[model samples]
Target: MGRKSSLTDDQWVEIERRHLVDGISINALAQEFGVNESSLRRRIKPNKAEPKKAAKSLQALAEMKVEVDAKAKHFAEQLGALPFAKQQIVSDLARKLTNTSEHMASAAEISAASSHRLSRMANQQLELVDEVDPMKTRAQLESFAALQKLANISGEMPGRLAALSRGQPPEAPPSQEEVDQELALLLGSGGG
Candidate 1:
């Protein structure tokens, strides 16, 4: 036997919203309103008061907009989109909708695209925030590790020089030339 998957809160809400908005389908929305199918379907069938009421609600919904920019942007961040990619996507969408200029939906306060841009921006920002914090942690760890290495070198260095002065072969201090070579390599050939 297959296991039954329970609907999440969001799924239930969406189902109920659809049912309410579309005029409940008796067979499809039985669990949506916690009702019986046959009885509910009968009740839904071409009623005198119901159709008119439903029609009025539909008209209102048609005139309304849910304005999901905040949620969309938040979700976008949760999903991890790049900043430029987010802007490009929103810009393209805005241009498509506006059909005149490429910069039509450029900001969050302009039009319907503003909501979409905000979502994309928020998503991208979340990704950036997530990435940067980890990188900063890694950099701190690396810096601490480097300092530990330097401390170890400093500790051993005096003893090595003392041994050299006592007639053992001496290791030389790191020269400026070697340091310059290392810096050049680290900076890359282009100097960028």
Candidate 2:
């Protein structure tokens, strides 16, 4: 003879309700009911109503899609009903704001770079001034004059000073050929 069920018919109905309507998993229900999982599954046989449930779910999804489409169309119609001049003004404002934002960002980057370069140059100049004695101001002025002359001749004084401040050798001056070309241009322009 087969083993008799420990649960009453009412308890079995409750278990089925939990497994289907409450969405309790079969394994969990089996553990709660103190029954073998296989026996619980066999007794429940949930597959019988799957096709009906699936059909209902698909119908609900289709209804929801129809609602969404209707709402979207209504929104589009409302947007289209706006005055053409108002829409044009809004579009133009949006474009101008976007362009202004880009320009501001570019200007900010340039300003930041220029500020950094100026700050570094100022700091270097301060360090140079600190190194010279105040009593030797006249000699210092003469040295500055010579440095300026060298800078003017090579067109690289600022670059060399920057490099020296960073403990680096100044970049090599332009080649003689390049210098000759520049000189030729100046002479040709009658302003040598």
Q: Give each model's whole-structure lDDT.
A: 0.51, 0.65
What is the C-alpha RMSD, rounded to one decimal, of candidate 1? 25.1
10 residues in a row with least lDDT, candidate 2: 183-192
- For candidate 2, write residues 48-91 as lDDT tens digits: 65635643664688799999999989967876888998777767
Candidate 2: where is the Cα deviation over 4 Å? Answer: 1-81, 131-192
Scored against the true structure, residue 77 in model 1 reaches a CA lDDT of 86
Range of the 10 consecutive residues with the lowest summed lDDT in candidate 1: 104-113
What lDDT tens digits, residue by residue, belong to model 1 across residues 58-115?
A: 5576655344666777867854766778778876887787763335323212433333
In candidate 2, position 167 carries an lDDT of 100
- How many clashes (backbone atoms < 3 Å, residues ≥3 apart in a chain or on different chains) does model 2 have? 0
Candidate 1, residue 5: how far the Cα is off, in Å:
95
TM-score for each predicted model, relative to the true structure: 0.20, 0.30
Clashes of 1: 3
